[model samples]
Target: MSIRRAAIWSFASQYASFVIQFATSVIISRYYLLPADVGLFSIALAAAMVVAIFQDMGISRFVTGQPEMREEHLRDYAAVAVGLGWGIAALVAAGAVPLARFYGEAGLAKVMLIIAGSYALFPFSIVPSAMLTRALDFRRLFQANAGSALAGAVVAIATAANGAGPAALAWGMVAATLARLILVMAAYPVLPRRPASLEIVKPMLGFGGSSFVISLSGAVGMRCQDLIVGRMLGVSATGLFTRASALAGQLTTLMVGAINSVFYPAFAKKRDAGEDLAAPYLHLIACNTGITWAAAIGLALAAEPVVHLLYGPNWADVAPLLRWTALAELFFVAMPLQMDVPILLGRIKPLVWINLLDTFITVVILVVASFWGLEAAAIGRILTGAIWLAIYASYIPRLVGIRYSALGTAYLKSAAVALAAGAPLALSRWMSGAGAEMGFISLLGLSLAGVFCWLVALPLVRHPFWQELRLALSHMAKLRTTQA
Candidate 1:
């Protein structure tokens, strides 16, 4: 299947997921749970997931990265996943009480124990999902993910209403994982019966080992924030931070997550075809930075009213943290395929170091910043982001065989487009004072103005993003015309 078709299916899946997860979260946050309630769950969930990284152990990349995935190899991968997934679930179940005691929250133990249930289903889902991805069969992914999202949402809302507190969120995850396992199994009904041979597992150890390290480090960086923040600033502060980041991250995820799922395999496919990866990589950066940067800025600018409108006055404090978190997303998207391109080029050794550095910087900076206060912890993200871009910029281009000058040129054009897109909103915010003063409706209007300016500026700036927009619009128009 074409990347375009796969992306469409992937986006449909993600779009449905975002809507379900977003709606459930809003309901829970506004009506059901307090920030401390969320924080309690967040800390436990973070710990469990950090260990749960072993469930995959790079199996998805290993599957997708393979040039010719024989049935025997699939069996091998599935065996490894089962052992690790089950082992990790046992570990999480065992540690729940200890971790909760360490955090001094009995509720943490309950949440972690509930979350442990999902990992039992993890191995069943992982290989099938990877197989679907390897085939670019995102249509199946859509079915599985959408069903999973709906199941999770319904469970979360129902449980929260029944006074399950934060455990409701954990139950929702368990439901989502089980639903995905069932759906993905139906979509691709095949699995290894038992463990693969020692020889089979030995060969995979090299790739899986590096991937495990990279994944472990990346997970630590991503999920450890809740742990670090909760320990230092207290659960309420962690709750506020988590709440702010959930919204900011959700918005960014809705934009980039679909592309992310598609791109690793897409890049591998291109590399196997002996295509020059540099151009596609640059084009990806162009498109990503153009859209994501603008949206992140808009979210930052509209954070106040967005918080007020979405979660009510209770979450008004999410505004400032949202602004910083949204801006931090720009750094992430600015360097597209930071992991995939390097892994594709057989540069996992350097990628591993980069990932370690990435995690180190993330933990150190956030820990120090948390000492000051919650918002300071967020501002610390901008510093970590800048450093992150610098860290990856040094090596990713070299792996992709792109010159720094060409990469810099792409950055400049994308930055220009982002600035053009953001200028209207920035000016409006400047004139209108805080987002609350402008109100949600006016803030939305300001955002529309930004979109209009973005459309108008694209062609004037002669950026490649203009052509991408035109192509997408033309494709949609053609589809409509055909239907008509």
Candidate 2:
């Protein structure tokens, strides 16, 4: 499949999954679930996810990224992957009760055990999914992910309606994982059956060992945002923070995350071809920042109305948190693919330290800020992001063989694109005054106008995203004409 086709498949899958998940969230939050319920589950899920990082073992990247792999290599990798997957499942299961007890919530244990069930099924999906991604066969990927989301959403709503409480969310994860596993295995049933030898496993472990540190900071650190808030504030506070951060994350994920899944292998291919990665890297930065920044800025400006619309008034506190987190997203995407770029460039050792420092800075900020209030923690996020960008400033360009000047120019154009995109909504908010309530129809209309302005401004600013967007449109038009 072509990159564009693969990306389209990815977006279709992501949006479908997001819609299901989003609808489920709205339903549960509005009617069924309480803030404390989500907070309890959020803490439990975060722990499982952090422990689940061990399953990475660099297996997917190893499989997808390598330019060459012998049959023996594949078999050894598969064997190692299976062993790691099962090990992580066991680890999560073992830690479940202890973690729950530590949190003083018995429900956390139940939620975690169900989460453990999902990880047990993860081994079955990992290799197959990676193989499909490497082949750019996103059709099967779409089937797996979309099916998983639908299954999960059904289970969540059904269980929540029946009063499963926090465990409902846990069951949703198990159902989702099972659905994904079935589809992925159906697509690629044959796995290398041979056992991995000591020498063969050595490199995988070494790479994974290094990778674990980066994942530790990036994945766990992000999740710890909730954990910290839950411990310091309360379950309700955690729920609000999780909702806010999740919203910010979901926006970026919905917009850019799907295509990013394709880029790992894409970048690997370019690397193997001995291409200078700077231009593609900058194009990626330009494209992603243009989309993510605008969406985030719009989210920030319209946080109150959006929170009211999707989550209802009970989640009103989430609005202010969302505002800061959304702007923090600007700095987060300022240096796109921080870990991935470093991983691809073989700068693992240095990346580890950078990530550690990144974690330290973020945690300290949150801890100190939490004393004031939820709003303080949220504001601290923006500072963390600014520091994040500064730490990455000197490293990324050098790794990608790009100069600072070129990076600055790309960022400038993307900033212009974001400002133009958000102009209408920002203007509307300003005119209506800070205390004004924006009705759904008005908010919707302004958002659409902002989108139109964004598109128009992209070409005006001579953005790389504009060229790519125009080309994509042209391609679609031609395809339609040919079919007709």
Candidate 3:
């Protein structure tokens, strides 16, 4: 398939997941799950993600390395994937009770164990999903993901209506994975059979092994906050925070994750073929930064209204936290680009150190935040993002042989333009009262004011934005010219 088609497929799948997730989160947070229940479910999901770190084994990338890979290689990868997943799932299950005890929630153990068991089913889908990406057959993968998300949401809603509470959340995952597995298996013609020879095992183990460490460290760095928050703040607070983060992350994942998915396949191919990496690398960074910053800022600004509209007033506490967290994600938008570079370039060692540093800082912040408040945890999150950005400043240039100054300029230019646009919105918010009704008239006023400020100021203050503005307009003009 063409690159555009692959991107469109990935985007459609992401949208499908987003719609179901948004609806479920809205309903479950407001009506079904209590604060404590949300906390426990968040904790359970976090633990499962930690296990997934090691379980993944980076065989996805390894599979892509094989140019003429046969059905036999697929089988062996499948066997390895199953074995690894089972081992991690078993470990998580074994520790579930202790984890619950540590968190002072007796039922958390069972919750975690149930969620951990869901990992065993994950391996059944991994190879097929990876193969689909490697083959650029996103349509099939999209079907699997869309099917899983839809089925999961339906099950969660049904079970919650039956009064399952947080357990319904876990059950949703189980149902989704099952749905995804069924659809993905059906999408492919080949069926799982016996394992192949151990020939490819060494290289697979070597490449995927470090990836496992990176995934484990990265998972801990990312979700260790969930564990700490659940223990310190209790389930309800944790749940609220998780829901907030999930909403913010949903936006990031939709944009950054979609691009990263496409980036890996496209650039990994270029890297494999000894293609000139500089242009693709620079293009990816520019595209990623522009899209990510715009979305993150837009989300942060819109967080209050969005939370009020979707989750209702009961979740009022989440708005500030979501806004702060979304701002932090502006720094993190560049993170996916940093990570994909090393993985694709086979230069993952830097990530080991980077992730370790990130984990230490993240753990410190989360623990300290727990002592003070969840708001502190949010601050810690922003700090963690700053650390990632700092590391990228030093790291990306070295990896690609580009000067740090050039990198700095690109980021600053984008930052300047975004700030130029965003400053007016903030001013308007400061002037407007929260009590004011957000009606069509008010929205139209704000929209018009924002556009007026952006259009007038952008042309005068930010030359780079003006240039891009002109280029975009010129392209459209050219299209018009062609039509005429």
Question: Each candidate: what lDDT?
Answer: 0.86, 0.86, 0.75
Q: Which ten contiguous residues of candidate 1 have the minimum total lDDT?
A: 194-203
Show the colliding residue pairs in model 1.
none
lDDT of candidate 3 vs native?
Answer: 0.75
Q: Higher TM-score: candidate 2 or 3? A: 2
Encode model 3's per-residue lDDT on 380-484: one tens digit a residue: 778878887887767776777766666666676556545645655566677874422355455545545655655665555443445545776786798899999
Candidate 1 local distance difference test against the native: 0.86
Error of 3 at 311 (Å): 1.4
Query: Which residue pairs clash in candidate 2?
Result: none
lDDT of 3 at 362: 75
Give the clash count for model 2. 0
lDDT of 2 by residue, 1-484 (tens): 8888898898898899898999999999998888899999999888888887888767787777767755456666776677777888888889988988887888888888888888888776777888898899998999999999999999999999999998999999989999998898899764656554678767667888888888878876788888899899999999899999989989989988887887878888889999888888888888889889989999999999899888887888899999999999999887778888888888889999999999999999999999999999999999999999999987888878888988889889989989998999888877876422678889888899999989988988898988888888999999999999
TM-score quality measure for candidate 2? 0.97
lDDT of 3 at 98: 83
Candidate no. 1 TM-score: 0.97
